[model samples]
Target: MTEQQQEETTADQLFATIGEQADNESYDENKVVNEIESLCMNCEENGTTKLLLTVIPFFKEVILMSFECPHCGLKNSEIQSAGQIQEKACRYKLRVNSKTDMDRQIVKSEYCVSKFPELDLEIPAQRGQLTTVEGLLGNVLEDIAIGQDVRQTEQPEAYQRIQDFIEKGKKMIEGDAFPFTIIVDDISGNSWIEPKPADAQNVWSRVEYLRSPAQNARLNLGNPEAPNVDDIQPDEVHTFPASCPSCARPCDTHMKLVDIPHFKEVIIMSTACDDCGYKSNEVKTGGQIPPKGRKITLKVDDADDLALDILKSESCALTVPELALDLHPGTLGGRFTTIEGLLAQVYDELYGRVYSGNNDSREPEENKKWETFLGNLTLAREGKKDFTLILDDPLAGSYLQNPYAPDDNPNMTSEEYERTEEQNEDWGLNDMVTSGYEEDETPAVIEAPDFPAGAPAA
Candidate 1:
């Protein structure tokens, strides 16, 4: 058939228009077109169904596209901005203080990371779902309910935990529980939160800022071009040789110096073993090695202190001295974030052990101990009880920004002390294992196992 005839055939196959006929909805204000002779992206079925695109006028011009496959019932929906992309990634934090706040509109793009810190709920972005504050809460509850019903059939305690989270969310929505924060990180800058009235006190007091360069790069914001570390001057390239922990294969390591905010230069080191495909990485800041180990402490007096910056290295140890709480490096990975964000992560880990396990089968005494721990954690987070955060790093990588040391507050303290022999050994600072073996010992050779698609190599 001629090209014109084929085009006419495809257009004739699209018998319905999305704006007027398919759903019989009115979208007179914004332009809505349907049946563009599009194939189902999922099923790859040509001319079997029509795709819908609607321009919804809101805080920004948003183009909504949806496709459904009649053969396989596959469905997908996406939101794209009509204007130019944002120069920088943005974060929106909404304080869910009252029922009125729950009515706030939220335009969550697929690339947004939605999080409810207090409830230990985090929904990472992949698929976009536009919803309101109340609607978001409902979505969370529904997702928890459905997932628990399906996955936790054998674990009654897990179901109970999800139910408890749902109940707490409902209470927050109804203004019964303490106010919580909902933070959304949108790399595309397509997501938005309804701003409160200007007359309201501290209406925009919630945390909002442009994400860091590393963060923007991670999100593929603006398709940032990666820096070529090899292009650096020869003097800047630091190279070392190491044996892989996985297969004992000799590997070449490279450390590229890069500048970070608050720090002049930090070394990004990576080691990859080609033999067994083993890889490891570590970040070290460039500075004179102090004679003594470092100890940093911060007192959390109120909610504002939660916003204090914390840089915890993978080798650093964290302790809440007041609560007799201590966390080692292996328990959690390093993170550069605020006090509240770190606490939320620790809480989620602890919460998983308490509520999302076979706790119902455990002794009553054991359960009580966990409950007491949870109570103590809640007290520390609510600022009802004072707590001191202590960060110790044998290496000078970890840092706790002294809120008062920098400005007016006098509660924070940072000191360098001698590292105990035990502390030094624990971090492998003086361990023989860290040093490459001499010629006397031959390196072990292990065959790399085949990993399934998308699986990490072992």
Candidate 2:
């Protein structure tokens, strides 16, 4: 029998056992069939593993299954609904204000997406794991601890910041903070934060519709004909053309729309040049127009600041003014990366340019300047020195997280301004043709270069 079938059989047998016990003695809650011999999936050994199944009847009937292979020490568990699949997705929002909230149970399915906005943190869905609110905090702490160790070696200042976050999380678990919110988006509708008892007063929790089109698409619940790739039509795809930056050969670029979890719309564009086998990738906003041009600036006072998330549009220009760093549009496109990762990229590129073999003949003074800049940048990343990060986007699609936002974060500020006439011209916004041809008119078409063999037709 299949593993699932075997699980059902086990549950049925356990139910029968529970029923037999009811006749002999008074029934008790938490009916469990533990230590049952089972084949080890990991080692492919027979009867070397133990399976534990518990029946939990709360608001709904739930089955908790756990198994462990003593030979390989592999353990697995899952919480499954005895009822039919939920017709709609579920979202659980918890306003954590006291230690009691931390004691609540959290059942996270493999498809649950957890977001902690206060910490500017998000944990993408994975395998189902049963944990309490406090245990969830512990899991986040464990992950940060591992990250801290790596940062300790590569980014000492960021390591110190992570250590501080861990300490703060510990205190928060003990009910130090007044209020924080944790949101769980479960596309499968199998996850939940335990509800407070009816007798409990002033508890904060709620359920709501996910209402995200992208999320519904991810769950494949929006279309009954989904999971069939053949149903896709030609009109659904978007394509454009551009010259390869390396070879200057005509290349076809394809744009695919994607959504960033708990964020805005994005388009991933990919193109490859058959002539030189050069590939290019870039991200752009999904045709969003900000009301006005924006300039965002942030002060990096410590390594903890590096955890900030940035969404830089393709038209955005970024720089570290303190280091005389300037990155304009066309130099680099849009991206979503942590502040620390962006700095590391800058450091690697500069290091290569200064110390590479081709640059060995550079003047001594220039070499000294490059070395000093590198050292200073390192110090700034470690929080030993302070620096300012500025993002200027004429398109106004860039964003930097403000930790104290809606309450005014003192270290960061954002401003909007009108674009200049010259700026509008440069972006081709002012050069549009207002005239349109008649319906019967067909403009002359220019012939495109022959695509390489086996390429999709244009």
Q: Of the candidates shown, which would achieve the greatest lDDT relative to the real structure?
A: 2
Tens-place lDDT digits, model 2, residues 1-458: 86655765665555432234343345564444455678877788654333333333222335556777767788777666544435345566677877767877787877888877677778898877667878888888887788565788999888888888888888777787648777777666677776432212123333323234455566665663355344322235577677775445588888777766545567777888876677756677765565578999998887889989887776677778777566554334566677876776667755653453233334577567767878877877667888999998888877787777568778898899999876565455554433563453754222211111110000
In candidate 1, stretches whose alpha carbon ends up further than 4 angstroms from where it belongs are: 1-31, 37-58, 71-76, 150-153, 199-201, 205-213, 219-458
In model 2, the Cα lDDT at residue 64 comes to: 57
Give the range where candidate 2 is weakest over 10 consecutive residues by summed lDDT.
Answer: 449-458
Where does candidate 2 clash, by residue pair? none
Clashing residue pairs in all predictions, respectively, total: 0, 0
lDDT of 1 at 34: 51
Candidate 2 wrongly placed segments (more than 4 Å): 1-31, 34-58, 197-203, 210-458
Local accuracy of candidate 1 as per-residue lDDT tens digits, 268-343: 7778988766666655556554557777777787788888877777556677866656665433544667887788
- Give per-model TM-scores: 0.40, 0.40
Model 1, residue 146: C-alpha shift (Å) = 2.1
